[model samples]
Target: MSPTTVAVRAGFRRGAIELRNTFTNAQDLWGYLFPTLILVVTIFFMRGSTVPGTDFSLGARTLPSALGMGLAFGGLIALAQQLVVEREDGTLLRAKATPNGMLGYLVGKLTLMSTTALASMLIQLVPSLFLVDGLRLTSAGAWLTLLWVAVLGLVATLPLGAVIGSLIESARNLGLVMLPMMGLIALSGIFYPINGYPGWLQAVAQVFPIYWLGLGMRSALLPDALAAVELGGSWRHLETLGVLGSWAVLGLVLAPVVLRRMARRESGSRVAARRERAMRQVF
Candidate 1:
């Protein structure tokens, strides 16, 4: 087959496999549903109040931040943990032996993870439009901003997940990897305004992508008057795109390299020995 044809066929097959895997996993269902529900409830009941430091209603600012958070947790952390466990179990190694196998496997994972993230965003949006009082989305600009930020946020975070998955040894060790990421999320102002954080904490938050993502989404979703509110020492929108784009570039370069290295380490005999040792310890 021509290389083009081969690549096209591989992508299609990988997508189908990913769809099947996503549907079969109840955990994916919960990952999409729970954050969406929380977003809906928070927007519906809390729209009237201001989001502290901003003139927009709490509902207006909260939705985008919540959606960003959902994407981070659902796409990055969840997918990374799954990849680590699957790699430890020899599933990734088995897949790698097939035609275009590694590409297909990654395609499936990305499709499933992105779908869940997008679904979670939409679920929150639906309730925010009709049920949430004082929630305004008057400008087409706001919608445009929301879409851009969400897509960029996913792009920036997913590859980092891939890299993390490649580095970790087991599911139990995921906590060590995840705790730092969770801290990033909190520092990014996903649940609250960053202004409340001390100067040093704000400086620390600037080092990660999540804070920039939240800032960008807020810039896109919040009213123009409220855009002046600083996050991590700059106007929310000004620094967001630049920071996120940089992270996306970095992750794209690093993730595949990390995954390839991890794959080399998990050759058949190595996995078998590890499993045998694990079994012996357990029994």
Candidate 2:
């Protein structure tokens, strides 16, 4: 087999092993489920509320929007977090030493994170059926849209996450990533309709993947009539595809260059220096 094929297989194996390990670990199990449980309760409470202009449960609408946000969060934050933490501990240096190591490492991470995000969405969605009304979960179209949007969201955001991870010198700087993301999330209309915001704010929110992710998701799971509440009174699948595809293209072009630069700078000495600084910050 070619080196690239071997590396891809190795990466898949690595991701599978890590996922199984996480499933078996008690702490990891709890860590994964706890946030999901909290979101469930949050959704349960929103059942009383209704989507504007229609009688559909707001909670149900929130569910898909939240799912899209989950994709964004997983693609951006989780991958970036792993990169910084692993870099601090010399994992990146080790990977740099091996043939096709970076390729394998990235593939493994994407595998791990994409599965985790899908699992989280299913976990939340299944229970939410009991609490929310007007979801089109029964329809095949819903699942298909969910599938493609999730895939596109991953493609759009993960490479950007890699670029961010490559740029930051320390894990502590993840907050810089978090703050802007949170602001975007707020403006993205995960809990509310983006149409409620001013036109300029609406335009600004549309520029990021979060809004498009939410929009794609809402299109997938919400009712057809609810589209009236959206910006153009339709799902705008074409626009969602265009915007997300553009981001995907941009990130794909930039990630390799940034990651290559970051990997070139990695060394034993740098790892040691970073570890020392991390220890200082901790203690």
Candidate 3:
């Protein structure tokens, strides 16, 4: 087999091992379960409340939106955090030294990210079905929409995460990303409608993937009539596709260049320096 093909196969195997480890490794499993639990509890409380104008369950609406947000979190923040932490710990340096190791590592991360996102969605969704009413995953159309939205969401966010991860010098500086991400989450209409926000704010929110991801998920899982509460009184699937696709394209174009540059800079000396800095921080 060609080197490229070998790299791909190794990547798949590494991803599978990582996925299994996520469950069997106690710390990793807690990292996986805690967020799902928090989202579930948040939705459970929201179930008793109805939408602003309509009698529909707000919790049900929030469920899919939260899933979308979770997807974004998985692709962006989670992936970035992994890269930063691993990079500091010399994983990237180790990969850089091996033949086609970076390729395998990248593939493994993609696999881990998408699988974990789906697991999280299912974990949140199954319990949500019992807690919240009016989620419609029964139809083929709904499932298809969900699939496409999720695929697009990951595409749009992961490469961007890679770029961000490449840029961030230290894992400690992750707060810079986290604060902004929290602001985006608040603006993206995950738990509430964005229709009431200022026109300019709505315009700004629509430009980002987080809003579109949440909108796409809501479109997939919620009933058509629920669209009334959404901006323009519709799901705006075309816009969602356009915006997310644009981001995906931009990220794809940038990630490899950035990652390559970052990898080129990685060396034993740099890794040692990073470790020293981290140790200093602890001491």
- Which candidate has the highest TM-score of all? 3
Candidate 1 per-residue lDDT, tens place, 1-283, comes to 7754675567667767776777678996676567667777777676677767655677667776776777777667877987987887998998778766777678777877777678777876776666544433788887887888888888988998998888887777888977887788878877678887889998998878777777776676665566556653445564677888888899999988988788767788877876887788789
Please report, as a residue range, the 10-residue window in candidate 2 with the lowest summed lDDT.
28-37
For model 1, name the residue pairs that clash. none
TM-score of each: 0.86, 0.96, 0.97
Clashing pairs in 2: none
The residue-by-residue lDDT of candidate 2 on 1-283, one tens digit each, is 9999999998999899888987789997786687678778878888788888788888888988988998899889888999999999999899889999988888888888888878877877777777777778789998899999999999999999899989989988999989999999999999899787889999999999999999999998888999999998899999999999999999999999999999999999999999898888889
Global lDDT scores for all candidate models? 0.75, 0.89, 0.91
Q: In model 2, which runs have C-alpha deviations exceeding 4 angstroms?
A: none
**Residue 64 displacement (Å), model 2:** 0.6
Task: Supply every candidate's count of residue pairs whose N, Cα or C atoms clash at under 3 angstroms.
Answer: 0, 0, 0
lDDT of 3 by residue, 17-54 (tens): 99998878889878768887887788777778999999
Sort every candidate by lDDT, greatest first: 3, 2, 1
Instruction: Give candidate 3's error at residue 212 in angstroms.
Output: 0.9
lDDT for 33 (candidate 1): 69
